[model samples]
Target: MLYDLIILGGGAAGIFAAINAKLTHPTANVLLLEKNAVLLTKVRISGGGRCNVTHACFEPKQLIKNYPRGEKELLGPFHVFGPADTIKWFESKGVLFKTEADGRIFPQTDQSETIIQALLQEAHGLAVLIKLTEHIEILENHASYFTLRTKKEIYQTTNLLLATGSSRQGYQWAEQLGHTIQKPVPSLFTFNVPASSLKHLSGVSIHPVRLQILGTKLFQEGPILITHFGFSGPAILKLSAWGSKYLHEQNYQTRLMINWVALSKEETFVKLQEAKTHFPHKTLLQKNLFDLPKNLWKTFLEILGISYKKRLIEISLQQLKNLAQKLTGDRYQVEGKTTHKQEFVTCGGVTLKEVDFKTMQSKICPRLFFAGEILDIDGITGGFNFQNAWTTGYIAGKSSL
Candidate 1:
């Protein structure tokens, strides 16, 4: 097949790139190749099917900070195109988005189908030829043209964009094409322990936990979940991302210290002291106004070997300190990691050094372009990753003309 531009991967970046390319060169034949039977598999399942469209933080500088992998390198690219533009682009497509308190934006319809339909609709309008079930196994560049060999056919194009993200196959293709790449690592995930406290609390969520890996500078905050196996939630997911290598080095065995209350020990200590002073006659076993789940609080106290039936006035200072330690510095053993639905990410693609961010074009292979998760430019969760898709995809799409 012959085309002006051939985009690999039918996901967010590739599809957006196709449409953007057509907008720049109306007559250019833009072909998008996807291996999956359906395009936007990640999009369909993202945010538990809601599809976090983009984050509310529209500023380029602030938006880039969310990324752990490509923050420094993305600064320049973001200045050219960022979250604000991402929101505007999607809004223009008729898929309205709204932000949550945590800055995660979801389709107002709360269905990922809406966002995918909008992309498919735009691609169709622009005459973008999409070929699903076509997996490109080889990408070779000769002079000013690029050739992509798939399982069934060989595709030739003047401009080529590789948006195949995360897959080692994608990384290999880029390395073969002479691009430096980062060694891929799992980013977002949850921890799995054999007999975790969260085993029975699958859906129990604690919002805004100040969590630290048992012995490191790494810590993160957001909502946390007690899964059937262990702990998950935005807090754990973000921590996993930020400390990917650290966790890997530790073999994921590092204990995680959580401030379940999310408040400083000093603050919580003061509150506890006030409670003890005022409620000296109160039974410790009874429920208190601390707002913690009763079962968890009771279990923690039990570990301290303190009987709940004991009167607050009768508790010794040593026991009081122990209770304080349990509340403010609870620790959990991390046995291993569990991938969060294939982590819905693209990293370790084409290296950043070889791509000109200004044009989203390859430096070594002229007339070849790159965008989205395929270029070692992955953003953190939120609309940041999606924004990368929009920006780089838009640039590659338009520049190919």
Candidate 2:
């Protein structure tokens, strides 16, 4: 059957596009194809199953900063359908949302199923046909329509939207359609410090910490979580997104510098010296000047070769300097990386320059569009990526119709 619009991939972007296309033109025929048995798999596992729908960042300019790859290209598209629109769109569908303190927006029910059901219901209500476990084996772009051959059958569509979300098949299809494919690389991952002495301190998190990738200008300041594998948290994930390409080039073997205190070395030293002067009788084990967790502080003292029983007065000037240095610039060798939970993001796909962000349409192929991680657009953790999917999906859907 010839469809007015055929959206490949049943993830957030594809589903959203299908719904929007039908909404824009009620008579238009839309079909969604998913290779997986289930739809919205990523949404089901996002935010530890809560489903981070979008960020509370409403301003397009401010919202663009969260994206490392599509920052510049997404500016115009976000201005059209930004996070505010996403919230309103969901709310219109009776899905209440709550924004967390960190600006991540999730369904008030706190269940990813709520989000999945909302999208599915909207699509069903609009008469959008959804086929599961259907993989398109071949795609041919004719002068007017596109031919897609699946293992089970063949279909044709006038407008095709690819929201495959970093799947290699999507890249191959886009390349086949005369579009340039950027080399895909993993993004939003955690560092794996195999030899880290702080492995026992897993689950310890520090707020307002600074993390810098040594030998590069990549850095991020936020909360850092120490996992048994390595470092996984806002700061590390943000740094990983920004440094995805560089880390991939380095083979995921790089040096990470952590500022536990988020303070300069000299500032940390001064603070330590003040602690010595004011609380000279306080023992190092009992007094943590930086407000770090007790276990983490104890581990730091051990790593610094300083006795926990040592009083502030007993700390020599050199020892104080060393402690300050350690707090401000603790270095770790990242031997590898682990995907940040199940929300695996990629840093590359269809090159941004080759796509028209204004309408999310392919510049090289007429009636062809892209959305979600299938394009070279990935944001750091905290709902920015979803915003991209929604924005691009909305534009693609509306424009295609």
Candidate 3:
């Protein structure tokens, strides 16, 4: 088969790119090839099926900061087609989106199928051919056109796009074509702490807690969860992305200091003094009184080995200091690491240095474009990953001619 464009992998980036490409030039023939029976599998599973379409942050610079690793490389991409453009495009398609208080953008209809249907419908209207279950095995880059060898047949196109997110086979394709693949690593995960105080306190969550992998400066906060495995949520996931190397270097056994309460040393110590002064005899586990979760209160008290039974009046000055220390800078051993599969993402692919963000085109291979998680850029949770799909797909579609 011969065409103007051939898009591999019919997920978020590939299909979206196909849709945009045909929209720009309705006469252009675009073929989207997928190895799966369905399209947008990742989009369907994302945000627990609601599909966080994009982040609420419309500013490109502010939006780029959310990505712990490819921020600098992502800046150019965002500045070109960022969050605002994504919202406009979706709204234009009759899918209105609303922002959660946390800044995640979801269709007011609250179904990923709605978003997928939008893409499918748009592509159908634009006459983009979606070839399912076709496995692309090789790419022959001639000076003029690109030939794609699939297990089933030979396909050729003037322009080609690879958006085969996270599949190692796709990485192999990029490497064979002169793209650098950063060693793949897990981007979102939960720390596995042993049977410590934080364990079994699983359901307890702090609204905003500091999570720092000891020996590294990486840290972030916001709704930290005490899971049966260890800890998770935005704070832990962001830190894991930033310090993935350091944590793995320590064999995931690094000590972590958590401030269950988002308080400074001064305020936290004063609060501890107030607790000691007023509820001198209350159990240390007494929670839901002032701070976030009460279970976290007990967990912190237990993690520090400070007996809550000690009478307030019986507590010595140094003991009060110790209590403050435990609450402010509690430390636990991270015995291991496990990707929070529920919100997991792959980091590192098709190194950004080799591709031009302005066009999502390979600097080494002309007429070949790239998009989606197959690139080294993966965003933090909060719809940034999907936004990358939108922006890169939009740009590639525009530049594909």
lDDT of model 1, residue 344: 52
Clashing residue pairs found in predicted model 2: none
* Stretches of candidate 3 exceeding 4 Å from the true structure: 274-290, 302-311, 340-343
- Models sorted by lDDT, best on top: 2, 3, 1
> Model 3, 171-274: lDDT tens per residue?
99888888889877777778888756667777777777777767777777777888888887778888887777676667777888887777776787677678
TM-score of each: 0.93, 0.98, 0.93
lDDT of 1 by residue, 1-401 (tens): 56888888888888988988888888888888888898887888888889876778766678777888777777787787677787788789887877898888898999999999999999999899988888776777788688888778888998778887676776777777778887676777788877676587577887667889976899998888888888988888888878887887788888888888877767777766776888988866663646777776677777788888888888787787777777778888889989866445534557688888888887876777777787776666666777777788887787876
Alpha-carbon shift of residue 185 in model 3 (angstroms)? 1.0
Could you give candidate 2's per-residue lDDT for residues 195-263 as a string of tens digits? Answer: 998999899889999999998999999999999988998999999999999999999999999999999
Please state the error at residue 6 of candidate 3 in Å. 0.6
Candidate number of the best TM-score: 2
Which candidate would rank higher by lDDT, 2 or 3?
2
